[model samples]
Each structure stands twice: as C-alpha cells, then as structure tokens.
Target chain A: MTDTALHTNSRSPGVIVLRWGLFLILGLFALFYLMPLFVMLTTSLKSLEEIRTGSLVALPREVTFEAWRTAWSGACTGIQCEGLRPYFWNSVILAIPAVAISTILGAMNGYVIAQWKFKGANFVFSLLLFGCFIPFQVVLLPMARMLGLLGIAGTIPGLIFVHVIYGLGFTTLFFRNYYVTIPAELVKAAKVDGAGFFRIFWSIFLPLSLPIIVVTIIWQFTQIWNDFLFGVSFSQAGTQPVTVALNNIVNSTTGVKEYNVDMAAAIIAALPTLLVYVVAGKYFIRGLTAGSVKG
Target chain B: MAPILDIKNLYKSYGTVEILKDINVAIEPGDFLVLVGPSGCGKSTLLNCIAGLEPITSGSIAIGGKDMTHVSPKDRDIAMVFQSYALYPTMSVAKNITFGMKVRGVDQETQDRKLKEVAHQLQITDYLNRRPGQLSGGQRQRVAMGRALVRDPKLFLFDEPLSNLDAKLRVEMRAEIKKLHHNLGATMVYVTHDQIEAMTLATKIVVLKGGIVQQIGSPSEIYNRPANLFVADFMGSPAMNLIPAKTKRNGTGMLIEIERAGGEIITLHDHHTESLPENVIIGVRPEDIAEAGFRAGEDVQEAECLVDMVEHAGADTYVVSHLGGRNVTARLHAETSAHPGEALKLAFDLSKVSYFAPDTGERLN
Candidate 1:
C-alpha cells in the first residue's frame, strides 16, 4: 500500500471534529466582522418608513433606487444642496496625484536607503521612520501655516500636498522594508551591466516592484479617500473631500434627518475603497507578507 | 600586452576599521585570478572594490590601463555574477540577458543575436522565456552567466557564484566555468571561500586572511610552497598536518625532532643554510604520508606509531595516529591492513615537508 493510503486510513475522529470546530469559530468571526456592511446595504435599500420601523438586520421589503439618486444628487452638504458627487471627484483628484507622488518618492527613498547606502543612511532612515509614529494632529498647525505661506491653503492642491506629506512616512517605510529584502547584488549587477541610477531603478527595480506598488497604492488610496481629518482641516466646503462631505451630510442640522439618504451617501463615499479592496485584495495581502519571509 | 586589470595600493576602510590593507594585484589579459580566504577575510569586499561597487579609501584601480578609481560602476566596463545569481526576478531569461544591452541602447537585432549566442553557450536556450523564480539554482546560475557573457566586458568579476549550488552541481559548474574561461580567455577575478574552487580554477590564487593578503601565487606555487602557515593550512582538503617540532643543528644540515607516543623520538634531516629556530612546525600534506612498506622511496623516512583510528573512504583509508602530542592524519592505500590500537609503520616523504616558525606562523624554510 502507498504511504498516502496508509496516512488516510490512520485519520482519527478527533481530527475531523477539530477541523469542523475550527471552521465554526472562523465562520462566526467572519459574520460578525461583516455585520456592519450588511446593515449598511440593507438600510440604504429601504424606504424611510421601512428603515424606521424594521429591525436593523432585516432585509429590505421593497428595494428602491430613489435613495441612491437622492444621495448622488439631491442631498445637502453645507448649504450646497448638491450631494457627494462633487466631493467624490474632489477625493479622486486629491488621491490620484497624492498617491502617485508619494508612492514614487517613497520607492526612490527606499531604493537609496537599501542600495546606495552611505555613512548616515541608516540614521536618515531612522529619522524618517519617526515620522510614521508622529500623530497627524501634532503637525496640523505647522502644516496649515506652511500651506498658507505656499499660497495653496484651503485648495485641492493644498489637500493633496497634505496627504502626500503625511502618507510619505508610511509609504517610505513600507517600500524601504520591502526593498531591503532584495539582494544588494542586484543593484551591483545592474551597475556592472552599464545601468546608471535612474536606469537601474526603471529597468531592474521597478519591474520587480509591482507587488509593493500595488500595496502602497491601495494603502494610500484608502487612507486618502477615507480621510476626514486632513480633508476638513486642509480644505473648505468647495474643495472638501468626500469624507468631509459625508460627515456634513449626516450632521447638517438645518435639514430633516434623511437616514436612508445618509446611509446611501455613506455607502457611496465608501464604494471606491471597497472596490479597490475587492479588486486587488489578494495583491494587498501578498504585498503585506512579501518581504516578511526570507527568500 | 598591458595588464587587463591593475590595482595599486588599494585600501578600503569603514570609518576607523580597515577592511583591506594596501592590496596590490595586477592581472594580465587572460589570467584567472581567484581571491580566496575564509569568511570575513574581505575577499568579497576586495572584489567589489575592483568592480567599482565599493569606493576604495585610497589608491587607484585601472582596467586596460584606464584609471577607474572614481568611475561609476556603469562606465567601468566590467560584468559580475553574484553568488545569489542576482537575475532580475521579474524578467524572463531573455529579458535578463538583454537588459544591459537595452540600457546601452543596443539595437534589438544585435541584442537578439548576442542573447542567442550566450543562451546557447550556457545551455539555457530552453529557459529563455522563464522567469528567474521558476529556474532551479543551477539554471539560475547559468542565466546569470548568460547575462554576464552578453556584456562581453573587459573583465568578469564573480562573487562566489557557485557557493549556492549543491556539491554535485557545484563540481559540474566549476568545470563548465573553466571551460568557458578557456574558450573566451577572458580576464576573470573570482572570490570564494572554497579553497578547492580556488586551487582548481585559478591560474593565480590570492590567499587572504583577516583582511590582509596572505600570499599570492600560482596554484602549484601556493600548494608546494605556501607563504605562511595560514596559506599552508587553508589551501588543501583535509588540510596539511602541522606537527610542532624542535629544530636543531645536525652537522652542516638541520634536523627536526618530533616526539611520538611512548617516548619515541623521530628525527628528519633537511639541508638549509638559514639559522635554525628552536621551535618550528613541520607541515606535510596528508597524501605524502603512506604505509611504510607501500610506495617506499629514497626520501621516505619510516616511523613506528600507534594507529588511533581508521576511516575507510572507498579507495583510500585515512588513518589517525598520535605524533608530537597531536593527532596526525595519513592517507594510506585502501588495501593496507590497519585498525585502532594497532602498531603501524608510516612513511613520511621529507622532501615534501615545509618548515614554519611556531611563534609567528611564518614559513621558515
């Protein structure tokens, strides 16, 4: 008899029970984690009366697109009365440039710290890593003043600038740690192959950076898109990001509380980040664990 | 022809700690120079310095008589194969072999031609489209060689390229590398901690220890006449057996007196004019020692000793015995009858022995 057959024949009843028990515990945790998202979807689909009287977990009796349309165009956010559409665009405009600039800059920083090491490179890296630990609230006043001096205060560019600066610490840390796992000999090999600094990064290192880039982009996109603090602090009503707009819509005192519209708007504001996670979640997890394992 | 590579008074240091001290080596057009030593011996550091990857603290490097001390590695016209076979992980084998050419703006036609040639030479054409991650260790190593071969650079630097391979594959690749060198007649400087690789592949071996060049010579020169005790001990498999002995004057010749077990004194005579030191080490290769009745010759001196252990290794048996209060190994013919605790007669070829000063570890004669 084969070893495989022998191993299969030796399975104990306790092992099967343990496996089923593990699945049961994990299934419970997954359902608990997804409960909020389920509640939001159901609430967004319900009419005002159904949402007011129905239990939070109950399925919508009559799903309607009216709330979605109102959330998309008719809702009020800070006297504008136009919904999250404009602010969603604002978040996009803010996040694309911010994520691009920060990720590129972080990749370059990581390359330098990992490959072109010098006497004080580690010290510089350590100092930069200290930025990741600093609370963003601590830098608010200084950043506002700096943005004011730069003549971009309360503008879209100002928000992008703020996000990039704040995001750089984490992005750089991620890229640096990931790039450190790559052998320094690769850089040496490229140099010997007549590849200069930028050329090597573009041809050699950049192609190998797909996993980390996906990781950094997804991280920065979610952080910037969902950011209420920086958006409210950096930009005023016209240029405010979606997160700030969503907050304004839910808390506006002048209008009657449209709970269904608010839930729909909240869902709208979260869709992009959700979409990103749904589309590239595998790459995200892979990137998170890329350099952790020794190759 | 002018030397293909020249390093003069090269010194590399990190802050206050020196890694390489005034290393000087000049290689001709087709010389295979192997920089070999134990770990932390700075062999890799020196290779990097030569490749222009590490900046030399002082002194200058020249390739084909062009000074390259301050030149960036890209413009230095050198190619290197790393021990990890640092092929670009994401690129296919074809792309990897052509990356250097692409960076230099070599046309696609020439790139294809050179790629095919290198792939064919390294027997990696079948794997041209596969990524480095998919290739086995030996195959990845060949791809690395293909990348370097496509460059056709003035000098090739190999940093322990075969150290990652299995022992069987390492032996195979070592021969293939030698064959490649014979075909190209390229100037190559390889760094490895494996002395067998150094002895087998290097036309000239530079033995290093503690970041200092211990000795530099041809393989035979290094083996037959090592510059110091370190090189003598390092270059051979099983290593040369160093028996500490006392040297004295015997008429016009010199005599080395070694004490065996049971108060047995064995004296060997050497003809040398230098003043004899009191305490010295007598270095003899393990293979030079044999059974007394086996391969007896004029220079062979027989000594009766107790065999402490015997290890059979197919064709030959390694017999361990006590000499001068230390274990000495002898490679005896497999057919010889020997066992532990048995009295045995061993022959030492005096002509093949080396003398060293015990205190300084320097070769005395």
Candidate 2:
C-alpha cells in the first residue's frame, strides 16, 4: 500500500517540480560552502605572479605542484628554513596519544559513573561535567604553573597533558550519556554470570562502545589538532604543532608573502580534521543522538 | 542436605522508608520458588537481594550451605535471566552463552562444548552466529536462557523473564521453562507479578503485598486456601468472591446470613463455629458456585439470585449475579441459558468456603 502511494506521488508533475526545487536549493548551499575550498585550491596551484594578476575565483591557468612542495618542505616559518613537515608530525604525535588517553580514561570514568553506583557518584559526575563548561582561557594560568612544577614546561608531553586533562570533560560527558542508554540489567546479568568489574567492562561494555569510541576520537582529534593557544603557549622551538607553524608561515615579516604557500599550508593543517569528518562523520551524528530517545 | 537457599531476618530499606521487613524464607534443593506480587510489592527487590545485585539491610543469605550475604555477585554462584533478556547485543549467541565460562578462564574445549550443549538444548543452535539484534524477541529470550543455562549455577534467578514476549510466545516460553525445570530439577527463584505464571510454574509460591509477605504455600494451597483477603483477591483469573455476611449462634455450629442487593437474605450453616465473629467475610472461588441443576454434593446450599450479566467463555460460561450487595460471578456450563434480568439458582459449595474476620481481613477458619 505504501509502495503504490509512493509510486503515484512520484508520477505527479507537481511532486517532480517540488523535488527539483528542493535539490536546487541544496545545491546552492553546497556551492556556497565549497567556494572557499575552491578559491584556496586554485590559489595554491597558481604561480605568485599569476596570483597577483588573476581573479581570485578563476581556475588555475596552469596547475602546478610547486606550492605544495614548498609548503611541505622548503617554506620558511619565522627563523626556520624548513617547512611544516616536522610540526605536522609533532601534531600527529600529540593528537594520537591525547585522543587515545582521553578516550580510554573517559570510557572507564563513564562506565563507573553510569553503571557503578556509589556514594556521591552523582556529585562527582556533576563536578566532572562542570569542567566541560569552563572556558579554555580560564585554566591556562593554573595549567601552566602545574606544568612548570612538573618540570615538563614548554614540551610536547606537557602539551599532551594539557589537552588530555582539558578534553577529558567532553569525552566523559559523551561516553557517560551514551552508556546510560545501555540497560542496567546487562551489568547485573554479567555480575551474576561470574564477571567482575574489569571483566564485565572489557568483555561486555567495551565491545559495545564502538560508536561512541569513534565519536570521542573524532571530537578529541579535531579539538587537539586544530588547537593554537595550547600549542603556542606550551611548546618549545622544536615541538611546535602544525597550526602554530602555519600561523608563523602566514605571518612572517622578513620576506615577500607567498599566497600560494600560505593557502596550501592552511589546507594542509585542516586536512586531518576534514578527512576525519569525511570518513567517520556518519557515526558522529549517530553516536551523538543515540541516547536522546529513551529505548 | 542443607536447604539450597535460605534467608533469615532480611530487611531492606532506603534511608527511612522500609521496603522489605523481617523476611524469612528457605527452600530445599530443586524447589521452584516463585515470588509473585503486584508492582511496588518488592518482589523484584527481593530477587535482586537473592542474586546479590542489591545489598540487604540486615540479613543472612546462604546458598548451598555457604554464607553469601556479603559476597559479591560474581562469587555468589548464581545466574539470572532479566526481563529485557539482557543479551550482550554486540556478541553473537555463541559468545553470549560462553562469556561466563571464558571469564572464569575455562579452557576452550569446555567452553565450546558447553556452548554447543546449551545452544542445542535451547534449540537456538542455528542462531548461534547471529547477533541478538538480528533475532526476534522470542529468539533473544531463548538466548538469554541459554546464557544462564550454560552456567549450571546452584541457584537460578529469573525476574519476569517472559513478561517481555507477546501473549502467544509468553505461553510457549512459560511451558518451556516449566519443562526445563522438570527435566533439570534445578533450584530456581523466579519473580513475577503475573499470578498465572506463579500458579503454572511454581512448586512453592510466596505472595507479597506492600513490601510484606502475605503468604507462602504450594500452588494448590494458595488457590484452595488463601491466607487472607489479599491473597484471595490477588490470585485466580476472575478473582474470589468476597461477600460480607452476618453470623449468629446455632445449636453447635453457626448460622451465616448474607443479604442480597434486593434485600433477600440467604442463610448457611457452618460445622465449626467456635469463637465465630458477629460480622465476617465469606470467600469462595468462582468455579465453586455452579448452576443448581448441574451441582449435587454434600454441604451444598442452593440460592436463587438475580442474574446481572452472562459472559459466554468457550468452555465455561460466567454468570454474574447480585449477592450480598456485591457482584458475584459463578462459572457455569457453557450451554446454560442464564441471561440478564432473570433469576438463576446457583449452588454454593459450603465445604470449600473460607471465612475471614471483616475488620482485619484475616482468615477465621
């Protein structure tokens, strides 16, 4: 019955026109959002002289890989003659460990808070949740002092520590809400089946956490990779992240500004987060909305 | 041998409000003990207390001659099937069934062998590779049972396990569970608010109300002789008819007078009348009252009642009539021509009647 209704609806001229109209509106929005990426790609492919003379919206007259090469290997950022290669690796190193540590810690915290009821559990959860609302700037002074006291000041590990500590609140919030939707009876059943604390979590909860794990990884990865304040404040000369390096290359004062390199560096700095969204964006939405409706 | 399960002086309370009070219950090995009650009656709470999922306020729970009051649930040596079936959604049927064994570090050969045995026993071998989400509700229920069955624990706890299935599936699973119990003869504790499930599945039944145990007896004893007004009203499909009547002294026995809604009085003689109260409630099962012509036995008293309505159930017809200022239903043969606005003679079996003091709702005789 529904199939016939759908078939008849599709055959109507007004329905076809309305559908095409909807597509046209969506196409316009897509073009509007893609305009900046198009301009950046075209600008990165053009020579400096062509860029100075040509329109910003025009396609590249001659596509070239020169800007990408220079941005990755040879472009100078501040006093460094090398390019974003080392700093890109630094960001990768920092974000992987940061995302991993925070996600695992958050999963355990969420498991305890959601499943293991103890005295003052709700209070502790509320306190941890309160951390998510604290602005990043509010914690900079105290965090820097703590990092200095720990003797890892201006180091990559110090930056990692900062990200994990700061990102834990969001990760815990995500995981706890998601885990709350799982029936408490599963834990009870496992308990009766002779499964202990770690056994139940590892054998039961962890395997079921795939969607939320993806969500936490994406969220923490993007937040840490794109971070500028922590990277600029907590890093030494060699440990600067890709975002800081990109900023330096774009804002350097001693030489002629290479617009192509600047655009290429910007896109390079953003490629990880963009690729993450493209690959796992579906689960991000699904995991976010998972526990919204009570099952 | 010691009783398989024992509870003494169990009390569960949350802060100030008490949930369970001074509960004492024990069952021998292989007894199918069912805790049946209405919602908020603490049946589920008592089940959890037994499973060690919830701590008791003050009590000692011993299972298989071992003290388990303070022991953790994993160390309590019990298995439970939840109302929602609580299958690990991410695991296949095989993994779900063998998870407990794998956790205890059982060898692969034993785990696989036990998994195969339980899967086949529950008739879910074909769905061993399927995730719980892929199967239907009844299939998931079977897998839940399989998960518990593989453990072969000393005590099995089921909390309304069949309540989640549809009506037909619930009936089928009910029979299956009964068959499993009969075949295995395993000591089990089941909790449910459905009295029918309790009647059909339990060898021993505990009826609870408002966090207190009302009565504990066999199914026949609970059906034939309820301890109080609550049990008489709670059990049975059509519910027992409770009629307020007046009592007077006779030669040695007593004379019970029940006034109908139209002010017609019917008197009955009781054999045991020592210390009988002036006012009392008479409890009788619906099937005990039958058409006058169809029933002829000792201690039977016949009375003509104004039929209010007639419900034609397939095997038996229910005749609702006015008696003692209340609606009394009598189960009669389906071919009877009893109808509304007409008088029908119903024979009340006095031998099976129960008398309770009207004030306390406690059984008098």
Candidate 3:
C-alpha cells in the first residue's frame, strides 16, 4: 500500500499539503456539527439517572427502549397524559394535504408566470414574492381573526390552511426559477401542436417537473411538519401539532424534568424529516440545481 | 389556383416598438419561400406571425383561401420546426412525433401508423423508445422533422432548423431537407440568416432589414440584379465590389472614368448611354474580373494595377488590388501565377457590369 501510494502520488508537496489542510478543516467542521446530534441520540437511549450522572459526550452504558415507549404513549402535556402519538398524527394530516396542495398551486403559478405571461404578470409575481419576506409574527393577529371568522380558528383544517398559505411563496419561487430554465420554444412548439394551456401543463410541463416537484415537496414537508408558530397559534389543544406538544412536554413545570423523555420526543418529532433527508438527500441538491445547469 | 399562403400588409408591434411593418408575402403551392436577413431583421418575427404564434398589430393572414388573422396556431394547419428542435424532453421519439395527433384526438391505431411511417422516413425507427435527451443533435433534428411531417399541415415552417447542427451535419441535413421538399412538393416557408442556404434552397427569397422588406425575387434575379445596394452586398459571399466612378458623354456614347492609385484615370465605355448619372458606383462581381490574356474579348478592358494580396482557395485564386482608393477583389483562374507587389494586367468584363447612383444606391442600368 505504501509503494502504491508513492507511485500514485504525482502531485507536488505544496499541492498535497493544501489538499490535506482543506480536508482537515472540513473534517473538523463536520465533527463540530455532528456533536449535538450525537449527544441527542445517546441521551435519548439512556436512563434519566445516567443522563444526569454521566458525561454529556459519553455513550450510554445500558441502552433501553423505555424512553421511546414512554415518549410515544405515556408522557404528559398540559392536562393530558397521552403522549406525542396523537400530535404526531395531527402533524401528518396537516403536512400531507398542505404539501400536495401548495406544490400543485406552485406548479401552476410557475407555468403561468414563466410561459403564459400577461400584462401584470410581473407585478403579480412581485406581490407574491413579498409574502416570502414578511415576518410571520406580523400576520399572526390578522390570520387569527380570519380563522375565527371562518369558524375554524383552532382546528386541524385551519392549521393546514395556514401552512399552505404561508408555503406558497417559497414553493412558487422554487418552481418559477426552475421552470424559467426551460426554453420558451417548447411551449411554442406545444402550442403549434394543438396543446392548450392545461394540456401543455399536463403533458409537457408536468413530466419534466419531477425534479422541482421533489424540491417543493421536501421543502414544504419539512417546513410544515416542524412549524410550531402556526401549529400552536392556529390550533387548540386537541388538534395541536407534534411540535407544540413536544414543547409543552419539555417545558411543563409540574414534575421532575425528564430529559431522556424530552430527548426521545424531540427525536420522534424530527424523525420524518431526518428520514426524508437521508433517503432523498441526493435528489435535494439535484433538484435545487436542476435548471441552473444546461446540458 | 390561388396562392397557398398570403400575408397582406401585416404589421406587428409591442406597445410603441414596431417589430414588423407593412409585411406582404404570397407563396404559391409547391414553392419554397425563404426569408433571409441579418439578426434582428424581423425574419423570425414574420415567420411566427404566419404561424399564428404572434398576434399582429394590424393586417390579415390567409391560408388555403381562408382568412386566419386571429386563428389559433393549431387551427391554422401549420407545422413548424424550431431552431432548438423543441422535442418534448420527457417523451420518447415515437411519443414526441405523435403528441400533436394524440392531442387532436386521433385514433390510437392511426397515431401508431403515422408514428411508424414518420419514424421510418426520418430513419429514426431504432430510436423509437429512446427519449430526446438520449439522442444526438442530428437524430434529435430528425425527430423534430418527424413531428412536423406526421401532421401533414397546409404549410411547413422552418425556423433556422439547421443552425444548431455541426457544419458537416448542417450541409448533409440541408441537402436532405431540399430533397424532402422536392419529394413532397409541399409549400415551405423557411427562415434563416445564411445567404448560402437562401440561395441554394429558396425558389423565392425575401430580403429584410430593420423590420422592412427590401426586395423579393428569385435567387438568380437577386444575385444578378439586386434592387438596391443592401441586397447586392448581402446576397453574395465575399460581396460584390462597388467602385466609385464618374460618367459623362464621350462622342455619342457614355464613358465611365475611374481614378486609380498615383492619380491615373481609366475610362470604360458604358453600354447604355441615355440618361447616365454624373456620379455613379460601378458594381462588379469578383468572377467578372480575370487575369489578362486568359479570356480577352472585344468588350473587355485591360488595366495595369499592383496586386496587393493573393489568396489560393484550390479551385480559384483571389487577387486583391487597389481600384478607386478601395481594395477590390478579383477572382482569377487557379492556373494564373499572381504575386503581391507586382504589377499585373487584369481584364474587366464591361458587358456585364452594373451602374448604380451613388447617392440613392439604385440600379441605373
């Protein structure tokens, strides 16, 4: 191995040192970033006594599934002992519909803004982009009043609506930037081939949109699933999302603080997003850079 | 029969910016009409207007004796091949060819049969199952053509279809397209900025500049008797040389006087004497000038000039010399031995020369 390394090492000493220096810096940064996640995983697997007595970075002496079970079914959140299972399901119901609806709307909006342009299309798009910049707190009061007027102020449907409304700005921006990279000639060719607006979108634009669709779905899924602001403000106790329930469980002032249960619950709330990143993480970068590069 | 396509006084504008003005074109059946111009000359704009892709600010368009000024592109019965070969990227070759038919609700059997026929004709049968991204540039161009061919529309439009191919492929595809036009005998309206393509493929050429039509004529007529200076200079390779001269009556005929280097004046008798302009520009093609003693005739005039440069192009050697204080190029036979900085006698074919008014650039005779 040493002889092979010597044979293959044709680069000069200065370049080799620079390369190793870069890897060293990047390796240190990655370790720093992974430290908190490592602690969270080990802490969730340990007992409350071990968490209090052991070093924060040490691996668990005896791994157990009790904290996971307790976090899933037995932990208390403000007057109920039922754990994060119900709120986890609430997040599921809220996120799925919100992601699907907002993504479809964003695709349509992108198609119109990119291809079927009209007189005030730029003005309208600029107005839509402004939604991405505004502070979420500024809209809380009006959104609350509007939800009350709609008679769904503290319901799961209201929370879904809130997430979809807020998510459109980002989804549209992603899709618009992506679709803009497609040549306008394709749309023209489709038009000459007898495809109308909806037909073109369904046949031509939709099939080529898989990359951007993945981008939008992942973005909206993560944003809505982890959202605590609207989840807490727009929904009442029964329909509160996982993020709000997890917050209540960890910060409750009644009993001894169960750091193990809190860590397990936090990991549970974050599991879906983590799984998505691990599974489709390669597609995430690919989709974000889809139209920016040309063949 | 009436013309297959007719555009009458068409005008297109975007707010205050006029993109095309007073455009008039009439294409007969089986005629290959080419719109040739420089970039931003509204050639592509006119083609899009005919295809109903762009709404005209004024005037009307008629195809197959039907007024279609406001008709949608699909209903207008026209097929277009874009410069980019805009095949549906997600679709296979077969699907790309049949997409229009499928959208028009053609039966499945008919779509399959048409797709097969077009695929076979374009020699893309092997690539039927492959998507456009998997194909090379030439294969993709064939697929684009197949998509247009399957429709059998009233008119065929090509928007710089060969501009994206490599030079060798462009030449091959150019010949193939010409042969296809010949075999189909279909009316085609082609747009390109290539003068060679226009000269070789067009039955009628419309030259445009800055959103206005300059002239419309056959390739030979446009090459031989261009209506204005822009057409003359824009239509040929290496360009025709325009030499400034003065014409006056000498005995009962007109004599044109041209000044050379070292203040020497040379006189040539003009064939047309009546109403000749006082100050004129003489336009001579490079082929009309030859090395002296090679094709000497009674009408040819000889002039002694210093050869500035010699370029050998295998078939012909181009010799550049000073005439009227401007570098004038002359095409000589390949066998001619010409060298720079040497005084060589060259013959001018006066019988074929054209005289134009210097001020207006209009042909005088």
Candidate 4:
C-alpha cells in the first residue's frame, strides 16, 4: 500500500469548532474597531438639527450633504471662511513631490549601500538610521533657520524641502533592507555588462523595486499628509495643509458647535491616505514580507 | 605564440588574510583552462582576478597580449556566467540577453539581431517574452549562457556555472559548454570544485589547494603523474591510495616493504637508480589494483589480502581491504564474485605507481 493512503483527510470536530470560535472573536474585534468610522459617516450625512437631536450611532432620518459642502468650501477655519479646498491642494502638492524625491533618493542610497558598497558603508547606513529615531520637534528650530537662510521660508517649496529631508531616513531604511535581499551577483553581472552606476540602478534595480516602491509611497504619503506639527510650524496662512486647516475648523470657538461639519472636514482630510491604502494595501503587505525571503 | 591570457604573480588578500598567493597561470588563445579545487581553495578568487572583478594586491594581468591590470570588468573584453545564473529577475529572457548591448548604446537594429541570434542559438526563442522568475532552473541556466554567448568577447569566465544544476542537468550542460568552446574556439576559464568536471571539460587543469597552485597539466598527466600528494588524492574518484612503505637500495632497483596489520610484510621491487629514503609513500590508483593476472605487465606484483567489504557498482565492483594500516580501495571487474572476510589475490601494477617522500608530501622519483 502507498503511504498516501494512510493519511487522514478530515480534520477533527474539536479543531473545526475551535477555528470557528476564533473567527467569531476576530469578527467582533473588527466591528469594534470600525465603530468610530461608522459614527462619523452617519453624522456627516445629517443636518445640524438632526445631528443635535439624533443619537451619534443612529442612522440619519433625513440625509443631507450640506455639512460636506460647507466643510469643503464654506466652513470657517482660523477666521477665514475659505474652508479646506486650498489647503487640500497644498497637501497634495506637498505630499506628491516629497514622496517622489525622498523615494528616489532612498532607492539610490539603498542600491549603493547594499550592492556597490564602499568603505564605511555600514557607518553611513547606521547614521541614516539614527536620523529616523530623532524626534521631529528636535529638528524644527534648526530646520526653520535653514529654511530662512535658503530664503524660501513659509512657502510650499520650503515645506516640500523639509519633508524630503525629514522623510529620507525612513525611506532609505526601507529601501536598503529590501535591496539587500537581492543577490549581489546581479549587480556584478550588470557591472560586467558595461552598465555604469546610474544606468544599472535605472534599468535593473528600479524595475525590481515595485513592491518596495509601493510600500515607501504609502508610508511617506501618510506621514507627510497627516503631519500636523510640521504643517503648523512651517507654513503661512496660504500654505497651510489640510491637517492644520482641519485643526483650525475643529477648534474655532466663535459660534455654536458644528459637529457635523467638523466630522465631514476630518474625513475629507483623511480620504487621500485612506484611498491610497485601499488601492495598494495588498502590495503594502507583500512588500513588508518580501525582504524576508530570497528568490 | 603569445598566450591569450597571462597572469603574472597575481596576489589577493583582505587586510592581511591572503586569499590567493602568487597565482601565475596562462593559456593559449583557444585553451579551455579550468581552475579546480575543493571549496575555499581560492579557485573562484583566481577566476575573479582574471575577469577583473576583484582587484589584485600585486602583479599584473594581460589579456590578448595587452596589459589590463587596472581595467574595469566591462572594458576587459570578457564575459562571465555566474553560478547562481544571475539572470536579472525583472527582465524577460530577451531583455536579459540584450541589456548589455542596450546599455552600451548599441543601435536597436543590432540589439534585435543579436538577441534573435543568441535566442535561436540557445533554443530559447519561445521563452523570450518570459521573465526569469517564470522559467525553470534549466531554462534560467540557458538564458544565462545565452547572455554570455551574445557578447562574443575575447575571453569568457564561468564561476562554477553548472554547480547549481541537478546531477543529470550538470552533465548535459558540461557537454554543451565543451561543445560551445570547441565551436567558438574561445579562450575560456572555468572554475569548479568537481574534479570530474575539470577532467572532462578542461583542455588544461590547474589544481589548487589553500591558495597555492598544486599542479598544472593535462588530465592524463594529472591523473597518471600527480606532482604531489594533494593532487593524487584530490583529482580521482575513490582517490589514489598512498600507502606507507619502507624502501632501500637493492642492486639496480629499490626494494619496498609495507607492513600489514597482522605482522605480515608485503615486499615489492621497483626499477629505481637513485638511493631511496628509509620511509616513502607509494601511490596507486584504485584501478591499478585489480585481481591477480587481470593486468599484464612485467612489473605486476601479487599479494594476498583479506577483503573487508564489497560494493557492486554495475560496471565495476569496488573491493575494500587493509594495506599498511590504511583502508585501500581496489576496482575489479563486475563479475569478480568477491566476498567479505575472504582472502583474495590482488595484483599491483608497480609500473603505474608513484613514489612520494613521506616527510614533505612531495613527489619522489
């Protein structure tokens, strides 16, 4: 008789029961975590009167988008009635270039450190890693002075420069760890194939970097987009990001509380990061584990 | 004729830890030289030094009669196949083959022509659009060879290229590489730890041990006349047996004596003109020791030995016995009908044996 015939095909009843029980617990935790988002959505669809009269968790009886419209175009933020439209565009501009520049620099730094290693490569990598640990509050004053000396203080470009510099450490760390998993022979082969440093990085390394690229984009976009401290400290009124604007709209004490508008504005500020995660969430998980195994 | 590749007194080290010491070797234009040794014997390091991948600490390398001591690998007019098959995981088989040309700014027409030629030559035209990750191990190996063949460089380097393949595939690829070398007449240097590979594929074999060259010769020369104990022991399957023997001058020849475990001393005679040392090592290959009367030679000597084990390997049967306090293996005909614990008469081909000085492991006479 074959050894395969001796194996049992069915799992035990206790094991099946235990598996279902574990899934039930996981479902309950998922619902618990999503309760806040459900409340926010329901509240955003209610009128001011309905929001005040109705319970927080109850579905809105008369749905309206008036709160959303006001939050996007007409709400008052720090004595300005221009709302989050301009600031939303500012965050987009800030995040796109900052994510792009930092990610490119990170991949190059990673390639050099991982493959074309020079003397003191480990030292340079450790120094960059040390940068990831420094608190953002510690670098704010010196960064402000540096921005002033560069003569672009309180501008969108200044903010972009700040973000790129600050985000570089994490981006570089991500890329270096991922690139190290690639065999060193690939670089040697490319070098023997008459490819210079930049050419190899462009044609060979960059194409293999999709998973880590998605990972870095999601990480950098979220960090730069939701950054309230850098946004508040480094920007003028016109250059403020949506996080700072959202804060201003939520904290204003000039009139009766508008919970519905505040809720709608907070969701709008968070929508881009949420959308990015939704679109590339699978790749984000894949990229995280990609470096652990070799091909 | 001037040799195509000349390496003069090359040395490589890492912070005083020498990996290769005074490596000097050369081959003619169409010679297939193989660097062979056990792992960590600096065979791969020597190959890397020739390809200009690793910088040498001292001495010079000349390829095609031109000094290339400081040239980069790409400009050295050489192509290499890595052991891992390093076929650029992100590229299609076609792009992987043509990427080198693309980087050097070759015209697209030439790139397409070369790619098609190599793809057809390697019989990988159908897999041109498939990425390396999608291909099997043998297919990836073919693509790697295709990548090197497309260059048509003056020199080719292979760093244990067949070590990653299965045993069956390794044999197949070994034949293919030999055929490629024959057809192209390319000056190629291959490094491998497999002695059989060195024997089968190399026009010239260099045996290395502990960062030093042990011997350099043709396969028959290496097999029949090993320069040292290491080469004799390393180059053959069921390796050459070096038995401790006592020798003395006897008229026009030397008389040898080997003491067995049971106080029995087996004596043999050899034609040697020089006075011999009191103790010397007698080297005999497994095939040289056979059934009595199996080998016909004037120098054939017979001895009775108790068989310790018998392994039937289809074409030849390996019989194990004790000689001079060491386990010695002898290859006999397949239908010998030998059994364990039985005494058998074995013939030693004295003419084919080698003599080594017992002190320094160096060849004697």
**Retained true contacts (fraction), each candidate:** 0.93, 0.90, 0.90, 0.88
lDDT (C-alpha) at residue A86 in model 3: 96
Error of 2 at A227 (Å): 0.9
Could you tell me which residue pairs clash in candidate 2? none
- lDDT (Cα, tens digit) per residue for candidate 1, span B179-238: 999999998999999999999999999999988899989999999998899999999987
Better of 1 and 2 by TM-score: 2
The alpha-carbon lDDT assigned to residue B296 of candidate 3 equals 71
Candidate 3: where is the Cα deviation over 4 Å?
A1-28, A52-55, B296-298
Q: Write one digit per residue (lDDT tens) for candidate 4, span A1-295.
A: 4555543334467778899999999999999999999999999999989877878899999999998999999999877898789899999999999999999999999888998889999999999999999999999999999999999899999999999988889999999999898888898899889998898899888988999999999999999999999999999989999999999999983768988899999999999999999999999999999898655
Worst 10 residues of 4 chain A by lDDT: A1-10
Alpha-carbon DockQ of candidate 2: 0.80
Clashing pairs in 3: none
Top candidate, metric DockQ: 3
- Estimate every model's Cα lDDT from 0 to 1: 0.90, 0.92, 0.91, 0.91
How big is the positional error of residue B121 in model 1, measured in Å on the Cα after superposition?
Answer: 1.9
Best of the two (2, 4) by DockQ: 4
TM-score of each: 0.94, 0.96, 0.96, 0.96
